[model samples]
Target: MHLTFTTLAANQTHYFLALCLELEKQGYSTSIISFHEESNKLIADAGIKVFNVFEIYRIEKEKNLNIENEFSALLSKYQIECPNILLSHEKVTFLIKDSIQLKEKFVLYFKALEKFFNELKQTHQNNVVLFQELGGFASIVSSFYVARGMGYDNIYFEPSFFKGRMFFVKNTFESYKVQENFSLPIEPNVLAYLENARANKTIVIPKKDASHYQHPIRKIVNTHNIKRLFQKLFSKYLSNQKEEFNYIGSFVYRHIRMLTNRFLFIKYYQPIPSEKFVYYPFHVPMDVALTVRAPLFVDQYYLIDYISRNIPNGYSLAIKEHPAMIGVVEYKRIKDLLSRNDNIVFLNPDINNHEVMTRMDLLLTVNSKTGAESLMQGRKVICLGDAFYNKSKSVRFVDNIDNLYKHINTALKNNAPNIDDINVFFNSTYSQTHIGELYYCSKENIAQSSLSISQYVKANYGK
Candidate 1:
């Protein structure tokens, strides 16, 4: 079997390298398509074939082939719906501000990816698979579309709701599904984790290193990252590298904006209200969880305003910043929402999420894990977007926002989920998930994750 790994960062590069080495022992060959040049060098040093995407883009650009009707033709040829989310990726919008430039660049990327995938298909045929870390960035998204168009088996991986487990799916930002008759015995640890979460205790997941938020300044001052920053600076100015993405520039801009917003808006956050309230936690901006999975709720401020206007008369809508985005979100928009909506209140970002859930009458979310957490706590939840736990008996999935009030009322009137139903839902999830971490690159994690992945491929693809 031949595996092609897509790596966008240093951590992912390390993780994929470990997977490649482990899988090689089992007679599988591996290659890499790296979006970051630093990752490309690291992969190459490991004695593996690595293709840099920028080099591919440059090669395709030199052809100067007409792509005037390529986008429409590609869609028709591949039977793929227009990939709006790929074009809307933050990297594309941030780097190419002009509309004409953006379209030209996208067409060039599409052409390059199509040609690259054609060659890969010719070489590996049905023996190849593509692995991508879950993301909404341009390169990954474009690659996914092109690979699917060329009839390749591609899997997107992300950390699951359970600790130390990962889920894989084929569609961008889609959740994994288990057979309706899934009958695996529920793991005792899964039950224990649910009980602990119900008691308002912290529950750790694979991607989380700690339960608390780390300040942006602390992240910037780290020795390894500082060294990386310097290396990137040198590469940008002193080297002849043609990079598609500016990692250092994006990092600096994000943190500077984060710090400025933190200083200016800390005073505006209020405590969770004593009155009866329904909670709405903010989703991280530019996160695939929002941009790809729930594009309708991308402007959360508007969603909040709509929710506040329709919520039951006696209940207020309590909102909080996502911990990962404490200072990263735009405060002016939040300020405008707060000023206009009297029924809405901003909770301090420092408040423990479980504590807030315990005090709220209901939870409202756009595909957030908090919806799952709220269900564990026996709190009624109304989901405004696609979520892995949307099938839970405790959740009310709202298909249309115009009828938001009707759903809210229905959820508020419904009883808490039965323990048996919760068990069944989680047991189904466990049946679908493989025991592993996504980005954690510890030796034990690497071994376990690689074994799980290899077993899955062997069973599914007979490789």
Candidate 2:
């Protein structure tokens, strides 16, 4: 089988290369569709066929191609039902505010990406598998739709609820839907992990996973960031490097906003109150979990306001910023939410999430892993979006926001998930998940993960 991996960042490129090396050893052919020149060189040095997306777009642009017509043709050829999916990417919306401009850029991206995939399909025609890290970037979203339309079996991988494991699925930003006939014996490690998490009343995040929540100042000052900053500057000004679509936004403005929020918002955060409340964990801004999976809940401030106004009287709506979004989120928006609603209270982001969940009357979320964690704790939860665990009898999924009050009350009245049911749900999850970490590039991890991934592919898709 031919595996084509799509990578945007340097770290992802390195990780994919390592996986490619391991997969190649198992007699599987691997290639990469790289967004940047540096990654193209690295993959080429590894003696792998590397398709440079930027270079392809540069070549295509020199011909002065009509993007509107090309985009329309591609859409018709693909029989794309929801063309709006292309515009739903967070980066696309974040970078291009003007509606017309966003559509035009997205069309240009579609034209470029369509050409890239066509070139790929020519070289590797049969038994081709596409792999991408689940993200809310325009390229990732576009490629996913384009691949599906072209009859390629595309797989997306993301960090699973269990640390050191990853969930692979065909659906965008959703859990693997296990086939009806599929079943695997529940592993003891799965039970042990859940037991430990419950016993300690804490979730043990892998160091690699926790690294995303590093302080913004520290991240900015890091040697790697400094080097990357210089490289990007050089590429933009001195080098003949084509401007990548992902880098169209101003990082300096983002950094300034993040830093400003970090310093100014401490005063707004209040202690977790003793009063009865419903907890709403803030999602990281621009996260695919929200941008793609829970698009309606993208405006969290609006959701918070709606929930605060609609929930049963006397119960305050408690909220805490996601640690990964500490300074990244807009503090002014959060401040405005607090000012507008008397019952909406802002909690310190540092407080133990499980601790807060334990005290809450009910947890409210939009496809957060915390919803799953709460279910593990047998706590009441009201999910407003497409969470993997929404199928669990424990969760109250709000299908219509108009009936938010009814859902909230219904969840409040419902019993916590039975331990047996929770076990059953996890057993099924364990059966579908592979033992590996996403974006964890340690040698030991890569070797073990590659073995697991390769074995899975062989068992499921090998001819």
Candidate 3:
């Protein structure tokens, strides 16, 4: 068997390489595909073939080749009907913006990615397995699309209901489909993992730095952010390239938002009302669960407005800001939301999420990780968007905005915690996924957890 690992960033560095090392020990040939040269060096030292995506793209583009023609050919290779997955990109609509020039520019970039995928496919044609962690980026999503379109067995880790646990699926669609019939008792491993999270206060702690979700620190240390700052500065001032791929704009925007917060002195975050209220935890605008699975509710402000206006008369609606989205969402937008909505109150992002969920009357979200966590905590959840747990037939899911009232009523009426479904879901999930920490959490799990790659590949792919 051949295992190809693709990833980006330092956070993904150790976890992915750990997986590769485990796979190698299992008698499978392995290769590493990464943007980070640092990670590539480590993998190369391990005697695995390492492909740096950026360098490969640069080298491949020098050849006498028409990218558009190659891109079209690549698309033709995938016969299955593809949905408009491009719309899932975070800033795609804004980038194109009906501008012919921008559209042309994006296509130029897209063609290059398609060519890279082509090169990648040709190199690994004999491979029976492909492991990827690139669905987060728009450009890299193309590679996953191509890989899946070619019908290679796919697997990726998604945030599970628990803090440390991650949900793995062979195919995206398969995760959403509930089993017809099964008899699997709740696993002890699942219980142990949750207890460890409780002991560590994992769910209770508000994740200050997105980069170090698992790493706990005594004081707020932002070495990761500082490193990113230096990288952006170098890309902007020292590089001096004509290409618009410079990171200055993003860094500048971030700095501006930080400055804006200091000067504004406008506090919108309110106490989680010690009264009856339903909570709607805001999701990061760029989350795949929001953009890909729940496009209708991507415009969170609008969704908040709809909820504020239409929430049942008896209860107040509480909204909490997502920690990572503090600067990304404009201060004025948040201010205007609190100012306009009489029944709506904003909860502080720093508040312990576990406590908030425990106290809240009901939880509502468009497929957020927090919402899933609420389900595990035995809170009544009303998911307005598509979720893997939507198949559980235990939680309330609203298909349309108009049905919010109905769903809310249903969820509130069936307010008792459905521990049975929670156990069943975890057991069903454990059967499909192996216990391993990737990207975040205990490094011990990565080293000790059994590799599920070969088993998944064999079950999903050919002999």
lDDT string for model 2 (333-442, tens) is: 88788788999888877788888888898999998888888888888888888777877665777878998898888878777778777777777776767778766789
TM-score of each: 0.92, 0.92, 0.80
Note the residue pairs that clash in candidate 3: none
lDDT of 3 by residue, 1-463 (tens): 6666666655676667777777777777677666555466777787777766555455555664555565455446653244344434435323334333332333444455455446656876746456664254544455465557655555666545544445555545323544412477667977776557544545522221344232112112367666765665664467632123333455456546544653352366678888788999888666666666676777899898888877778788988766555444557777787788888987766677877888888998888767667777778888787777766655677788787777777777775666776767756755654555556435566554434556656665543
In lDDT terms, how accurate is model 3? Answer: 0.61
Q: Write the per-residue lDDT of candidate 1 for residues 1-463, one digit (tens) a residue.
A: 7888887767778888888888888889888877777677778888887877777677777876566565566657666575565556564325334444455566666676776677777788868788887777767777787777777877988777788888888655576644423356777887877777676567454563442256666665668667877777887778756444555677777767877887777778888899999999998767787877788888888889999998999999999988766777787887898889889888888788988998999999998888877877777888888788876665787878898898888878878777677777776777788888876888899889888889889888998
Root-mean-square deviation of candidate 3 = 4.6
In model 1, which range of ten residues has the least summed lDDT? 91-100
Local distance difference test scores for all models = 0.76, 0.76, 0.61
- Candidate 2 lands at a TM-score of 0.92
Show the colliding residue pairs in model 1.
Answer: none
C-alpha lDDT of residue 27 in model 3: 76
Residue ranges of candidate 1 with Cα displaced over 4 Å: 63-73, 91-96, 171-173, 178-183, 208-212, 242-247
The clash count of every prediction, one per candidate, is: 0, 0, 0
